[model samples]
Target: MDVVAWQFLLLVNPNDEDAALQQFAAFRAALEEAGGDADPAALLRDVIDWKAGFHVGEDDAAGLMDALDELASRWRQRIDWGLDDDADAVPDTDAVLQTAFVQLRERHYSLWTAETGEATLSGWITHERDEEAMQLVAGALGLSARPGIG
Candidate 1:
């Protein structure tokens, strides 16, 4: 996709409707000089929401499992610390994460909540996902099932 100077300016400052044409030209010039074939998608790979959480830091299976175990433990604690008077009412959190497993897929799956938003996939998931996996992730993340992102 060829990005024009005006398009570059719009991306840089969407609110600045009054951005000068000369400034945009200069910006595009610099961008072209730096590299015209720069992949925008690759540059913004980390902009996804599912990439949140503690990095495995290592590329080995043991390291990935350790991270997943730690994440599961922390989430379980938040779901039910066992100190509540009605602890029985709080169902086992393990059932929700039963399907959680480390797999070498095109993308890494993740689940987290607003309060305990400290979980992440050990590796980066940078490809498309099926509907079933998306639903599983949504449920695990405690996201609303109200259809769209309204």
Candidate 2:
């Protein structure tokens, strides 16, 4: 499926057109890399950090926190992980992530997780204003994703 530039723009660059355009170029190149038939799921990793996104092992709570913190810092914000960012202090990776997701929502940022079929969680963050349209964006790119919590 060929996703339009505008749609890609919305998904990666909801607030900055210039940045979105830059990413769109990279996204297009990524699509072209597979002879114009690349799997969107696979292409996600390449495009993730172009703006902000993460893919980490399920049990790597510290890594997740670090990735999230880096993304948040890009926006001049921080996540209230509800505790110190020590992996041991965190009871469950799920709970720590759930809390971060909630905190992100309150800041107009949406954190989404996708099923990876592995012992890992992968997803991206978008502005809250774009939250409602994220699933559609995912569909257009042929990705199955949802907001998950535990």
For TM-score, the strongest prediction is: 2
How many steric clashes between backbone atoms does each model show?
Answer: 3, 0
Model 2 C-alpha lDDT versus the unseen true structure? 0.70
In model 2, which range of ten residues has the least summed lDDT?
A: 1-10
What candidate 2 gets wrong by more than 4 Å, as runs, is: 1-6, 84-91
Predicted structure 2, TM vs. truth = 0.79
Q: Please list the residue runs of candidate 1 whose C-alpha ends up more than 4 Å from where it truly belongs after superposition.
A: 1-54, 77-150
> Can you give the TM-score per candidate against the true fold?
0.22, 0.79
Candidate 2 residue-wise lDDT, 27-97, digit = tens: 66888887756776666555765356777889988788788788777667788876654545754678767
